[model samples]
Target: MAAPAELQAALDLLRGLRERHGIDVVTTAQAARSAPAQAAALALRHLLPADLIWHIEGHEVLARLASGDVLVLGLDPSPRVNGRAVREGRLRRATIDEGSARAVFELAAALWSNPKFLPEIEPIGTLMPPPSDALAVPRGMEFVSAMARSDRPLPKVVDEVPTPGWLAPGLLGLAGPRRQAFERTVWNALRFLLLHELGHVCLGHLELGARKQRYRMIEELRIRDGAAPPKAGGLTDEARRALEIEADGFAAARLFGEAHERDASTGLQAGMLSATASALLGAALVPIIFHAMQVFSETPEPLSTHPPLWFRADAMMRAAMPGAGTGALLDAPLRHWAANDALQRPLAAAGHTHPLLGQWLGPVIDGGLDGPARRVLAEARFARDGLLRGRLRVQQQVVPSRGP
Candidate 1:
């Protein structure tokens, strides 16, 4: 491990940059607060890169720091923050080894210098201290005053203690075969979130708002869309939202590159896998009558944010083994027979077929269908039902939405 003095020097340098760059950071320390919160803070600090500094307060650390620039250290939580202290046992015992710590610190440092690391969203100037600060801290208000010193005047990070009753879901519960699937989902989701945030910073949407009214409108829209609100001293919701979408697109393009359109194709392939697996599993499991119910229950509902599951399963099956002629038209009986077997078998009877589903749903057995296959299936069904097909040509009445 690097010497404490050396670490301190690195921290000093980062903080200096934050000050010079106009970035704001918040601090939290375990030695400054109750035992529980302190431990959690300590664990959090270690897990983070050394480029990030640990701010020592009384018993806890809850301040934010710039993820890429600025390290916030030293503060007394009792002065302004509210909440009971955390317990030591509840905190995970994992420590950042010297090597990993150095690696992370270096990563952060490199990111700081990289043009890619620049903020994608505009910073919203705001700050809030811990609840304890109001109770006994005369200088607790420094949280806001400190913002004045920043050159960028952006809230880079916010540090606050976790609530007393807070319980982070255990990773163990997500273990086993299901765990891998869950991790895939979580990984993609987290990556998406980070990308979106980066997009905001990179796109320069922060400067779009000029007043509280405009900012508030942006914030409301973001909330309605199910995004996490900006931290106490972070960027505005509008900036974050716009940036998040940008990041998602960036990540999608970067990860898939020239295969950007191929991702859709890939997703379709996964859907085929899901469909094949579902059909096989369904057939293996129970009575033929039960097959219809299982298929119906597992069927993807229309108008969902996600694509149809059956369609995805079918697409994946096609991708896995390509070059087959139109099986639907060639062997109608065979398709039904095959679907019967698929419907009987449980997805668990199969292995990691989630990836065959594509993107978020690719990791789990329970998810939406493939888009292409869903359309094809719908068309096939439509063709089979001539009456319904003819009805499609009739005019339909438009239903207006009720005012909210």
Candidate 2:
């Protein structure tokens, strides 16, 4: 069956934008055959809000991009990792690089498939702090770091490293239930990435920026007209940080809503637990993805737009599982510890550890500590309230004025 005319036009607009951005947009027929595209199709079908439909020029277009509406470009060799959402007028489109998506899936497979990381008989316990010599570097850190940070093609990088048994043969080699489970993990991770971008669009971050810009122009005019100098009336650095955090919260809430709805409808305890676990895992990977792409720093920078990766991870957890105490919040930190330890084992056996791992592992591992966890929860609360107010102020300014 053919797509409606409006939906086809929306897809065409997305294709043009992908090409303009040099993303090597593929034909709709070709995209249908791509794995990443298929994953995206499943996400759009199951994850997107059913009630939401977009209208362009009085004709309805699908709210989210249908499977092949945008290009699924191959591995991005550039430093920029993860998917991006672009807006052209009322239309918003998102695209994910196959390379980054593959990297995330491979990481998940490396950890999940390995018995050492996730034992079948028992759950991994809380982790202790790294030893004093931890700074000396673990064994396989070098190879992992190179694979993560190198601009070289991902396949080439993987080939250069000694293939570990865990990740060997890559994601494709798995079969039966294991493959199904692996695909779910990848889709969960992709869902988080896709929704995070969608959060920016839905939350009106771009619109907020425009409002701030217009406010500044109006304020400047007032200042030049011999009126008292206008106070700061634009988005500040802190405000930008807040917007990023808000988007993370938005994504987390959407994930939680989906899980909750599924659980409610099915009324199956096992299915509910599995869905919840997958949602948490997806949220936890958001920070790891940033770190792997080399976009995240171990410590927060003074002028950085986004919060530290750890903080964002914490914020998402708090938002998704509201009212949960410190004990509940420990899920993410524990998962990080297990994943880090698992990945390290193979690398250490190979006599090298990733350099990037050492940088963030200390703080992330420490996140399991009661002191740090409490501090993060408190800080996240304060930040969330402040940002919400800032966003409200922007909305007020941009709202159309009512006639007197």
Distance from true location, Cα of 314 in model 2, Å: 2.5
Top TM-score prediction, candidate number: 2
Candidate 1 Cα outliers beyond 4 Å, as residue runs: 1-176, 207-244, 255-404
Q: Residue 226 of model 2: what lDDT?
A: 25
- Per-residue lDDT over 99-184 for candidate 1, one digit per residue giving the tens place of the 0 to 100 score: 11111212222212222211221111111111221222112112222222223423322233122121122222223333333222
> After TM-score superposition, what is the CA distance of residue 310 in candidate 1 from its true location, in Å?
19
Best by lDDT: 2
Worst 10 residues of 2 by lDDT: 215-224
Model 1: worst 10 consecutive residues (lDDT sum): 81-90
lDDT of candidate 1 at residue 19, scale 0 to 100: 56
Which parts of model 2 are misplaced by more than 4 Å? Answer: 1-16, 23-37, 49-80, 121-148, 151-179, 212-237, 261-273, 295-303, 319-404
